[model samples]
Target: MSGLAALCFLLLQTGACGFEILGWFFRGKSLTHEDITERAILNTTVQVCRALALAEGKDFTFPPQPFTAESVAVACGASKSSKSFCKAISLIQRKNWNVDLFRFYSSRHHFDDETFIEGRKIITEGLSAVKASNKRENFEAAREKLGNILHPLQDFYSHSNWVEMGNNLPNPNLIRAGTSIGNIAGKYNVTVCLDEIEKRNA
Candidate 1:
């Protein structure tokens, strides 16, 4: 490969997800996207191992890789994390035409919208099974489901005007049932983009 091409590929492998919305999750937690993924997979694997060890007297085995569901399966003694796990993770996190990105960046479908309750439910169910069951299949299933929810949850902050509402903190009640996200402005009076250019000229 050409020098520039090799550098780009190296960067791709070594670089973090610098996309603002996606990177938000890793900002306070890990320096790179790979690290974040490894951490999450490890968390799921550890939880499953712990639960399995407790429920069935099995030994805990760590995840074998930071990428590829196949490696995770080897570590967990599953067939392949699932029939289609690694492929799904790849497709889900793909840059263009990825449903994960589309939904995560969808602002009007606001993060706190009640319609999005399914995401939280997925996480809760997955975690509950991972914590209480000896089934590796069930545990991995939960991990995958929970995996799909996190991007949008982190994207909630970047896509909304929460930073503009004069509060330095995110709304603590974003997804809680029966809680308010506060009274949204009845008017869309905020200036943006072209307005800013016009105002500057005015």
Candidate 2:
């Protein structure tokens, strides 16, 4: 029995076993790794979607649109906006709170360096895709598109950063700017418009 216990401990430390035996010792229920990961994914996905919605000026309470696997793949394959949408969907799907995950991992003596690194990697990939798609045109078009959509507030175009200003400006006008951005995001069904704005700003 002692040898069995030792073997279980070793397996847990090595991440070789699905079940975590230490749960019994810690007065917690045992759970499989896949189960935990799936739950985490779902939680993360919901949160991310909510954040995206909020950024676009929409209420986060609306149910997430059903995202099929094919849709996920296609969106991921699309331009920078699509990639950003994909990442947001993926994170929302995970449904796990990042801070909680960090704490849980730390409690288990696991490092979360990869989590942060992977997030940055995804951002980089999305930026690259957007840039590659925009190479054919100058930045002016992108800024114009954003300005057109955000015209309700104001209209200013930034060529260097590709930002289109609506009536809401960002410094003396920062709050209004954020409000305009959120409202625009909420109004659009397709995420491509917002994605373009992000690409320009990037």
Candidate 3:
């Protein structure tokens, strides 16, 4: 077996193969926003740590797959018992889930009801909020706002034609001011390949 495969086999004995286990559990089911958000969070954390390590000209060991806040904290040189970072993780996850609950009345918050432009506006404003909060050293508030925005930002891919437009990567323009996010599919207009996805879902 390869090194990663051997490690996964060992971790499996301890029930610590996080992504392996999650992949099995969610095999047939569609990923919830919480799952997606957590995965993205872990990925972002790992990439940032990698970049920082490179800048410092140091070797960086990655935390286990599907990293938790504690693991990431340790890998990034923060205390594993750090409450603030863990709290930030929980706050972000809760905010991501809350959109399904409290924000149900606002379809644009979920990129539902064909409110594409409004959803983009929420992301733009939320990004600004994150920056402003960070500027004030309100890390908790910044994380909260990040979680709030991630919901609609993620929903855009699920509910729109950014994919069918032949782009495999995320839209960079979403964060750029005054730039178009490309042509959005309207309520009256049908998004290409969306019907195929619905058919698959059904």
Candidate 4:
């Protein structure tokens, strides 16, 4: 199996897989913004770790279970880079996270432009780094970066109507090069309701 597929399959065993994919439906609003992003990171990390374990022909388990960014931050608190990374990760806001790259990757958006090409290049490099490296720390960093890149790709499902427009299927072209994103509009669009500043705050 491909490393990415194997990673995802293993991540599903962690229960975080369900949380990351389906939790957005029932628990999205209940989940803290950090919970949403951190869950994605945790699951993605599990996938990478599992893939590494498989490659090494060993079993693996992530301790300090129910892996939260807070727990990891505390555990790696002494490392300045880990602390900075964790802090930055916790700041993923709904409207602002991955804002720049979000527009470049879609049949609805640009259908494979410079931004899209660059994004894919980065992800391919990140995945290669994760799979080919023996350094745990480097793997962790690469996993986090890969998750960040993937965050918006997954968001493509939540943010756009490909499921409807493409007959309840995903626009597979979004992940590939030299293909149209179906008959999507010129931009990927979704109507989401955001909590506005309260009158008290105003």
Q: Pick the candidate with the highest lDDT.
A: 3
In model 4, where do residues sit more than 4 Å from their true spots?
1-35, 62-65, 70-88, 91-155, 164-172, 183-202
lDDT of 1 at 190: 53
**Distance (Å) between predicted and true CA of 135, model 3?**
0.5
lDDT of each: 0.44, 0.32, 0.67, 0.46
- Model 2, residue 136: C-alpha shift (Å): 20
How high is each candidate's TM-score?
0.41, 0.22, 0.72, 0.41
Residues 144-179, model 2: lDDT tens digits: 222222211111111111132232223222112222
Q: Please give the RMSD of candidate 2 to the true structure.
A: 23.7
Candidate 3 structure quality by residue, lDDT tens digits, 1-202: 3221221122212211122113323564466666666666656666677777999999999988768878888888886555777676778878877776788779898777778778878988888788788889998888888778877777677776666565655665555557788766544675559889999999
TM-score result, candidate 3: 0.72
User: How well is each residue in 60-112 modelled by candidate 4, as lDDT tens digits?
Assistant: 65548787655544443333456655654544433223433464335332213
Please rank every candidate by lDDT, starting with the best: 3, 4, 1, 2
* Model 4 clashes, total count: 0
The lDDT, on a scale of 0 to 1, for candidate 4 is 0.46
- Which 10 residues in a row give candidate 4 its minimum summed lDDT? 10-19
Estimate the lDDT of model 3.
0.67
